[model samples]
Target: MQKPALDIHEIPSPGKWFLLSIQHLFAMFGSTVLVPFLTGLDPAIALITSGIGTLTFILITKGQMPSYLGSSFAFIAPIIAAKASGGPGAAMMGAFLAGLVYSIVAIIIKRLGSGWIMKLLPSVVVGPVIMVIGLGLAATAVNMAMNDADGKYSLTNFSVALVTLAITITFSIFGRGFFSIIPVLLGIIGGYAFAYTQGLVDFQKVIDAKWFAVPDFTIPFLTYTPGISWTIILLMVPVAVVTISEHIGHQIVLGNVINRDLFQKPGLHRSLLGDGVATMLASLLGGPPSVTYGENIGVLAITRAYSVYLFVGSAVMAIVFGFVGKISALISTIPTPVMGGVSILLFGIIASSGLRTMIDDKIDFGEKRNLVIASVILVLGIGGAVIHIGQSFQVEGMALSAIIGVLLNLVLPEAKKGE
Candidate 1:
């Protein structure tokens, strides 16, 4: 098997570090900015918070785990819902609570082992929930890709979206090495260029932007605070379940890549605590919730540059970039069609990953117990089943489904042997 070019502790030369960190920056940039854009948050704040989040994570983990925290896609819909219900303040409130959920789970895992959590969630529960998270946004992707700002279908916009998607898929399947991993970035660039040719991009934003600007930071209750809405909390906090599982899964994958049991050495609790802290920090600062970016992990595996210092450089660069007015302005100018095109692939991939999880775990649909759990989750999630609670708020969609799945898994009996 191939090994990383540089080991975790090995420090590269100044020049190499700069170049390698740039690679990680671009690898993370596309998806990181996309989340903020979709959720009506400022991309610049996302960058700043992402950088700060990573630094905090590294510090808390004692630099044993090499992970870059960025805006998490899982929270896109939740953030939007929270914002719509009560405004950005309520959204951040939910986000903060979501991070708290992570911290709480980290504490639980620290006290107890991971065995009980795994038993509570198993593939049957997790797989469909993951699918719902993705498929839930299918119409949103299409509307963005095909519709104009007026929400009318535009053939031009549709064409641009499809072209972007095509470029992304082509790169994903056939591009070589580093080119393959950065397909999202490449696709966005390609689509943006095409959209420019069609007069779809507005250059005024970039031209008018200041050279240096501080990212707008919105703290809950500082500017605007809404009344407590359990709906927002229920909407946002439950997605933590998916992301925490994602973090643990990535830890296992990273350990496998480096031929070391990270859970044993650095300890799963420490890494999880680091992630939780980073997320809480991000939410407090008015950025979207952060997660361990798989894009950076892919970069580490491909380049074999596992040094923790590299991420430090990347984080610093990210923060600096956040202060550059032009970068954020340019990122904003990227057309909805361009994003929609890539989002089509991304959202689908999210759902497909659910299938992959089930397959990897060999979840048997033939088993009635497993079948019922998955069936309920997929319907409740995708069908947008909402349960009203009193007049103030209610549980709906993914959160409701997730809660039901966990309960069903716990309540249902185990499958018989060779029934």
Candidate 2:
């Protein structure tokens, strides 16, 4: 029972188009901005870079794909480590190297028809990895949801998060049209208004801020710091394994939503190239690394709006907002609990999508090899086991788990078709 999809070429009226574009932007905002908020990067720069990255993706894919590039949660820990060890320069360099890894993969995929990708990382591996990603971030979401004014855990913040979560769930399940599609935005508004009644919001910054101010952009290698080495690149590039798996999973989900084989047209190679180039550009500008946003996919599932034109509009709007400091500052003032509430739903959907992938493909969970691969990947990923090499090199969490899963899948022989 698939709903009819809006064609890629179909254009709604100007008013409707503007609203839909903003809805897409709203869909991506919580996740996109959170990367910068968590990693101490400039939110304005992140937005601009994401906007550019997304446009680059569309161009490279020949406007066939409808996706928005946002700052990747996968790189949060690595970036933090890189910053502490060397500097922002080291961190950006690491991300740039990760992009190079994507480029190399794209080259391989272009030549080798992507069949090996499925053989190496099937549903048994990817599904558990996706589950681990959501579970791994559970603590962060809870902490933020309970953070008080003094930055300590408090029941007041928890209450607000609960209210936000409730509203979001209600709207997503029952609300009609735009309300249903943009539940996260409505949830934030509802929670923010409630907080305002309690005098939690500070309006001083908004009042003091100018109407328009140029964005403070930083060039990573030139302005942020100076230095790049093979060690930094090696430590970071391999982490692309997790993001790549996530990318493939998302493409599969998007194909289901739109009822089209995106994997065929434009194909994985083009998408990977687009993602790699965009990520590299973002890193060069000291912005957090970008990835295709799963949040937007959730929006499409809810709204059934599959027009690529809306994505272009969203990209243009993000670029416009990036040039305005006051707007970015205003968005930054959203309460932590509000975002925490959204994250709970958002991350859950991502995990569920992975499950959907497994079920749709009818992966044989009864098979001993499949069961073992899934089991090991989930435990290692969620348990936070780190493999340290000397002082400067390490791989752990989802990245390490994904690598292990791939290797195991390679070594294990699959059962004969009818066995």
Candidate 3:
């Protein structure tokens, strides 16, 4: 690994702290807010909880693993599912349960090495499930890009989406260095500006919103009481399996980047605890579940600034930004088409990531069993196949596909040792 500009434990000067931290804030800002915007959670609360979660993570990891926690795109579909089946309360409850799943896994990884988990959820299972997570949302992106307030198809909105997509693609493929990593942020801003000229953006909400006020929170007990719903549980808990795998993968990549074996030093269990506890905290406060942001990882890689102090400073700024009502209103006012435009690229990138994972690991489709595993997973997940356990609960889509993939991998025989 390269020598980082800032060491993980180094405390920068007060001036450097503010400047370096703000860079991370920009790095994580777009994707973090986008999650809650898609899921109907308050963006302000998401910011607040993510900041708090980052602090908690730093504490738990003993500042050995320097990463920023933010809203997870993986949970977007399931949160929408849980919320639809029950309500916002149910969504938060399902998220809490998912966080519990993380804690349980952390304990297991602590007791035993993570080898068993990798065996259970090999690339064959995880790859396609991740693809399902991304492709499943493809329609949502298109619909938002084309639909108006009344859900009617509008060519005008579609144009905005197209513009947004083009700019994002330009930055992603053509832009150099730090600019390339932040295409999502730049695309949204460009699209919003374009929409403003066309009379598509409505700034009345922003104008009316107070400069300083408490951002509205959708608290579990206070907003709505949560009930045990197998429907929500079945829909959500299986997704945690995928995310835990994601967490481990992130640890590996980050460890590679920082020239420190994060898993060994902080220990995966303690770091996982930080992520789990952060998720639980977010659900309690009506924020989406948190994950270590890949965007911020990119920022760290480019800047070579690995300082824990930078992360702390950034997290503090996020919490501060959350209370500023003007920020909340401004975020809310971003046009749906603009969101949709960026989302098209975002979701597709997710699906592409699964394929990239397979390619990176040399997953051989020439092997019939491997081919079968991947084939079944794609169809079941993307085809929206459902398996009903009872009247009230069912496993479907991504969750169902993930469970089936694991079972099939377990049952399938390996090739001859000679072969």
- Cα-based lDDT for every prediction: 0.89, 0.80, 0.90
- Residue-level lDDT of model 1, residues 169-255, one tens digit each, is 999999988898899999999999999999999999999999998877887567666355778878888888888878888898888
Candidate 2 stretches with Cα past 4 Å from truth are 1-6, 10-13, 149-151, 226-235, 256-260, 295-307, 416-419
Candidate 3: tens digits of C-alpha lDDT, residues 40-127: 9999999999999999999999988889999998899889988888888899898899999989988998999778988998888888
Each prediction's TM-score against the native? Answer: 0.98, 0.89, 0.98
Per-residue lDDT over 1-419 for candidate 2, one digit per residue giving the tens place of the 0 to 100 score = 56545666677779878988898898887678878876778888888898899999999999888899999877876787678778778888889889988899999999998998777667787777777767777777787788875779888778888888889899889988667766777888898787677666777776777767766556754577657765565446756876887788778888888887988998999998899999999988888988998779877787787888888889899888887767777777777787787777766775676677678779788999988988898889789987887875667677778789889988999899888
Clashing residue pairs for model 3 = none
Where does candidate 3 stray beyond 4 Å? none
Q: Is candidate 1 or candidate 2 better by lDDT?
A: 1
RMSD of 1: 1.2
Weakest 10 consecutive residues, lDDT, candidate 2? 229-238
lDDT of 2 at 250: 79
Question: How many clashes show up in model 2?
Answer: 0
